[model samples]
Target: MRVLYCGDVVGRSGREVVIEKVPELRKSLKLDFVVVNGENAASGFGITEKITNSFYESGVDCIVLGNHSFDQKEIMNIMSSDKKLIRPVNYPEGTPGRGAAVFKTARGKSILIIQAMGRVFMDPLDDPFAAVDRLLNGNRLGSQHDFILVDLHAEATSEKMAMGHFCDGRASAVVGSHQHVPTADAMIFPGGTAYQTDAGMCGDYHSVIGMQKDEPLRRFTRKIPGGRFTPALGAATLCGILIETNDETGLATSIEPIRIGGHLKPTL
Candidate 1:
């Protein structure tokens, strides 16, 4: 199975880039499935139902949320009805949306995509490892599902890497998001699971982590609350990873980092 997991989509730049690039990538890469982290798609805060629908229409099979999962309150209205929309698994028991779901490709193969939020330097939610363990233990990778993808929306790189190693040999790929900066390390683990510290944000990189530089810089250098942080209006660099899993073992055979447009060096 070939899958592409995009990083957090910040704002208009991120949304435009994704809407423009996904269809082309899907055809060129021959992707069987696509998932995107959309926690920051709404003016750099949260995503809405409209944005989610745009993604689906543009070829996104599933959408995952992170720390700002509910920033756009309107999403909760359709959270229960939208099977393709996923939130952090560790979010309390009564969280609006699901954390994991099974999606079937055109070829009739099933892939389980799970999203978990890390507690280290993040929200004091449930233990991510424990939450993931329950799901991983319940699902038989090669038998019940053709592939399993875990998206750890975390702040600490250590936590992300730990999750990757923890789920080694069990999931087809373990990718991280929320940092908004693409890491150079993209490799398959010893156990055949693909790992990347961060897939980066599909937003303009010219600013401070996809935000307009003025506010972030003002807060950083002067340490005073000036105004709300907004997304950079420049063209965005779509960042993500493409993973190809073995059909029989349901393990990753290859992993590749992708960066296109904007300031980052193009990987294509």
Candidate 2:
């Protein structure tokens, strides 16, 4: 199973980048499945039903959310109905939406996608490891599911790394999000799981983590609010991680970091 998991989509630049490049990447890379974090897709807050629809039309197989998963009030309505869109599994009980799902790829293989939010530096939630473990209890990685992908939307790298190791042989890939900056590390773990500390954001890198620079800068220096935070209008760099898993073992055989367009252009 070949999967491309994109980072957080922040506002218009992020959305546009995915709409523009995903189709091309899908064909060129021969991706079987695509997972994108749409936590910040709607004006840098939470994603709406329309944005989710657009992403699906652009070939996104599944969408994941993070701490900002509920910023958009409309999400409460659409999430229950949209199986492709999942919220954090650890977001307490009866959160109105799914936290994990089993999806069939174009090739008709079943893949399990789970999204969990870290507790550190984030809203308090259930123990993510325990939450995911309950689902994986009887579910074998290669047999019950062709592949398993975990999106650990976290703030701490330490926590992300621990989760990767915890699910090393169980999951095919474990990717991180929410820090919004691509990390240099992208490798297949010793246990065959492809791991990355963060997949970064699918938005402009010219500003602070895809947001307009002015307000963040002003707040940092003056400690005062000047204007509202908005997405940067500059060209965006679609950041993500591509993992190719073994067909038999359902483990990652190769992994690579992807950064395209914007100031941080890639040769690939």
In each prediction, how many residue pairs overlap at the backbone (N, C-alpha, C within less than 3 A)?
A: 0, 0
What tens digits encode model 2's per-residue C-alpha lDDT throughout 151-265? 9999999999999998989999999999999998898889899999999999999999889999999999999998899999889999989999889999999999988998996
Point out where model 2 deviates above 4 Å.
Answer: none
| TM-score of each model, paired residue for residue | 0.99, 0.98
RMSD of each: 0.7, 0.9
Model 2: lDDT equals 0.92
Query: Mind giving the per-residue lDDT tens digits that candidate 1 earns over 1-268?
Result: 9999999998999999999999999999999999999999999998999999999999999999999988888988988899999999999988788999999999999999999999989989999999999999999889999999999999999999999999999999999999999898999999999999999999999999999999988988999989899899998999999999999999999999999999999996
lDDT of 2 at 118: 95
lDDT for each of the candidates? Answer: 0.95, 0.92
Candidate of highest lDDT = 1
